[model samples]
Target: PVHAARLTYEAMRVGAPARRLAKSLQPLAGRCDARLVYAYADHASALAADSGPRLLQVADEMEQIGALRYATEAAAYAADAFAREGRQDSARQAAARCRALNARGHGAVLPAMSELDNNAVMLTPRESQLVQLASQGLSNADIAERLVLSVRTVESHLYRAMQKLGVSDHHKL
Candidate 1:
């Protein structure tokens, strides 16, 4: 069930058609697992529906279940939903909760949130892609080669991405 939820969540994250898959997994929300797969399923469904309120509810439930990782991921999803809805204050609150959870060492940071600024502003797509590669320890030249771009362009992208993410260096990415 947890694996199904994770697969659904990944599908939704990529903007794939996951509404049917999420609906099919809705019945598992009552089941128990070490990682609280039920809550993860609910969160994934809410994401598929673009429902911020439901995501927030799932985040609260995840916190109660001691699933800090899922809680933070849900909060980050809720933050993004709220931002898209023009609810800046609510988005900020959710993002702050996510940051607090990470700061307390409750769980690993969500990969999607890794490229956010201190205030949870999202990085551009190019910026996010560059940051992900750099975080994997790829050098500018290597990234350039892989992306089929000039080394200078790769460095520029990394520099701008790092600046937006508030990282002083690529090593920090």
Candidate 2:
């Protein structure tokens, strides 16, 4: 549910009062979505703290923890918030950051569950490149440096490639 959660509050904007949502939001107080909800509310429903800056901070923290999906989500929200707040420069920067992370395969779109479930597995260009480099005995860090990707991203691509290729060993590739 967390993975699929969105940051919109359209229903709230035209419908319920803030107090009405308080009870429902209580359970999510310490969760990541709480910040998303409240930050969104802060922009529209007269809550506290500015969302643009806060969401960017949250995005950075999530990225540091390797929660790329969450980071991308937060940055996208931040960009929207900044744009709404008349902070055009910050909005563009946040949008660019969101795109960069989303390009790392952490966008809102979920992968097709049946993609890897098929008998025939196809390698994406990035996956194929990572696999080839790994087969050449390059460390993940080395590949990351050459490819301008994070080490974790390199490792993730290789892991997915290994699964698709039906190989348990990187050395055997």
Residue 75 lDDT, candidate 2, scale 0-100: 68
lDDT string for model 2 (26-132, tens) is 44433655455444433332322337787677667667767676566666667666667866667667766766776685444423111221212446788978987
| RMSD values, in order shown | 7.3, 14.0
Q: Which candidate ranks first by lDDT, i.e. highest? A: 1
lDDT score of residue 11 within candidate 1: 72
The candidate that wins on TM-score is 1
Show where candidate 1 strays beyond 4 Å. Answer: 1-18, 30-35, 118-173
What is the alpha-carbon lDDT of model 1 when measured against the actual structure? 0.71
The TM-score measured for candidate 2 stands at 0.38
User: In order, what lDDT does every prediction score?
Assistant: 0.71, 0.59
- How well does candidate 2 score on lDDT at residue 132? 77
Pairs that collide in candidate 2 are none
TM-score per prediction, in order, is: 0.56, 0.38
Give the clashing residue pairs of candidate 1, or none.
Answer: none
Mind sharing the TM-score for model 1?
Answer: 0.56
For residues 101-149, could you state the per-residue lDDT of candidate 1 as single tens digits? 6655454656756533433445567877888899999999999999999
Off by over 4 Å in 2: 1-50, 107-173
